[model samples]
Target: MARALDVKRLSLVRLALTSAVIVLALGGGRALAAEPERPASQPQPTPPVPAITRECQTPAGVKTAPIPLPNTLRALQQRKKIRILAIGGASTARSGPDRGGFQEVFERIIEGAIKGLDVEIVNRGVSGELVRDAKERLKVEVALTQPDMVLWQVGTSDALARVPAQEFETHVGDMVRWLRAHKVDVVLVGIQYTRSLAHDPSYQAIRRAVRRVAQREGVLRVGRYEATEALERVRQGRQPTPPDPFATTEGSYACVAQYLAQAVTLGLFARRVEPRRQRPPNPAPAPAPEMAPTPPRPLPLPPKGG
Candidate 1:
């Protein structure tokens, strides 16, 4: 019986050894099949926002022309308030988001650009209006709002309407001069630039007319065309510009707002500002005539006595 028990024990121990070997083999296969151990990877750094992605993100390379926002600057200095009247054609009318449009974006940008100045922009954009219509409305609106500055978005409508370029120039010049005479500064926002219209004679002519008017008046015209074209190139991976430069995208409008804001801020702060006008000195009183009165009285009395 003892010898049988010993044989059974040896069999049981062999069975256990075989099971352990199978387990070890299976585990080794799994380890060999599994992926090898690797060094822990470092976290990837976040990429920067590209200039083309957002207008506000990039340095605008702002061209500092002499804007001389005289009244606007003066009011900002004294009253801490500056009001702007935005008058224009289609671009100004529907050139932004569905709710508030580009004017709203412009107001927020201006306010954000210049600290400690209350900037109010009133939108008086009438889509499809020519320079004549804009001028007429400007008169009434100026009388009502009495804004310190007039952001005149011109040229596009005149070009589209086939108005004579000279006539367009005349109308724009007249209004800018009128605004200046009325102590209001003018910022002429030229026509929206489109690659499609670059070759169009009428559009180019009107653009030239607007530029001439701005130059003649010595007012600031935001470089809407050039700046936007540059931005479009940057956005399109430096490819040839898109045919419709002003594709009416929210991003396009935002870029416009940024450019306009930069222009206004530079005009207000960077330019040589006009000092507050001093009152003229009072005129000197006229001198009294010298007295030969005593001698004359004596002569008259002697004649009466004789």
Candidate 2:
């Protein structure tokens, strides 16, 4: 009876040990299968933007603070909502509900390019006002709206009024500087060359002067003459050129306005893509070292003199 009891007891112990080993083996297999895979070495992607440096210059060759686009304008474009106040010559001012001309065309183009974007373009163009007049009226007429971007289109009237280039430059520069000081983004649209002006040396000289001022001021140029020239090229190719002597007739003006609006939309896109500046990458924290348990230290040696 004792021998039989010993055999049964040994069998029970062996069974328990086998069951525990099988469970541990199954658990180990599951853990291995569930482990996540990792790549050998992950590479970080390069940033999409190029670093931009801001700088400004004065007519007297004095350098001033870097005058880059404002962060507020960039932020607004990113949000897909931009408020634009276009103040200039007749080209910009003719878009009112009552006028129903190039302005409507520009509005349609703007709406098309920036879908779902809240864009408002207010036109305040007086028939024959020069740069000084526009600047004088801006405070009461335009500043009240507090637009994010201002398209200054006054050089045409300035040239028509025979305003000297230097005076024009000073007035325009002051207006731009003031707007910048107040954190407004200004884009200067150079004057469109008329058929009469194209042949007139004096008018051409004024156009060149306007371009110089615009460049020195760091203002974006819409290149009205180039756009008109392109349209003229297209018109020339047509066997029967239209009766209109003006390259920027109602139809041509509509086309140019559409193109300009698209250009504005692209500018807005660029603002969104790059923003004010590229932010530096955050530094990674140093990894903690794995600390192995220290072995028991040997008993301290007997006191040095002992």
Candidate 3:
């Protein structure tokens, strides 16, 4: 009976030792897992940023950089002087009884607008000429001047001559293309309405066609038709019958001439008054007094333990 009791006690002791070993192993595994997780939760240090450098250098013996020339200044230096050549058809070529032709009025207006710039204006107007006729004489009338810009006022006689829209477009397009190829800028003038065709379907059609061609070709267009219509309204109120082109009266050809001159001049003036770009000023240098060294600060007190 004593030997049975000793064997049972030994079995209980062995079970207790096995359970202790299992608890120690589980606790040690948990500590190892927690150590790895703690490191993951901590933040990493940030890298240092690089400094930016400037390309342009400061002037010699000076801290501040010299101011750069403005775009407008640079552009002005490179700009070619503009020379304009005015070419008119029919009415534009005529100096009404008041001696104010489209050319004269336009020239005066443009001249007034460009103050310091060199500008030259020329007038080559011919009465009773069609597009075909103008094209034939273009070399002598326009190309000879070697103008930088050409103000072409045609299509009135062409419309009156019953020229087909296609043919008229062809002539104008060819003329413009040729001028552009030679580096000449162009502005197209639309046909003005006369008393005969003021309300005519064909007149409206002609004006529409000209407007489309001007837009498609990227040419500047003058609204001569609208101007004439306005003038007609004013004249109708003042006169019994529309004054003849050759007649000199208050509401006659003289008035029309004055209007044409003003319109053309204003148009040219507007083109000359375009805004220009300016450059930024250089930053001022630091003052000599500001560059002096700062005074030293008082030192902090030692910690209690130290």
Q: All candidates' TM-scores?
A: 0.65, 0.59, 0.53
Candidate 2, 69-171: lDDT as tens digits: 4533464546757767777766344433436445566766666654565667787767677887777787675568777778766577777667887888888
User: For each candidate, what is the lDDT?
Assistant: 0.74, 0.63, 0.57
Candidate 1 lDDT tens digits, 215-258: 88889887666666666655666454444545555666677677
Error of 3 at 40 (Å): 57
Provide the lDDT at 247 for model 1.
54
- TM-score of model number 3: 0.53
The deviation in Å at residue 221 for candidate 2 is: 1.0
Candidate 3 regions off by >4 Å? 1-81, 91-100, 243-306
Error of 2 at 46 (Å): 17
Off by over 4 Å in 1: 1-64, 91-99, 237-246, 271-306
Error of 1 at 68 (Å): 1.0
Please state every model's RMSD to the true fold in angstroms.
25.5, 20.6, 31.9
- Cα distance off (Å), candidate 2, residue 92: 12
Ordering by TM-score: 1, 2, 3
Instruction: Score candidate 2 by lDDT.
Output: 0.63
How many clashing pairs in candidate 3? 0
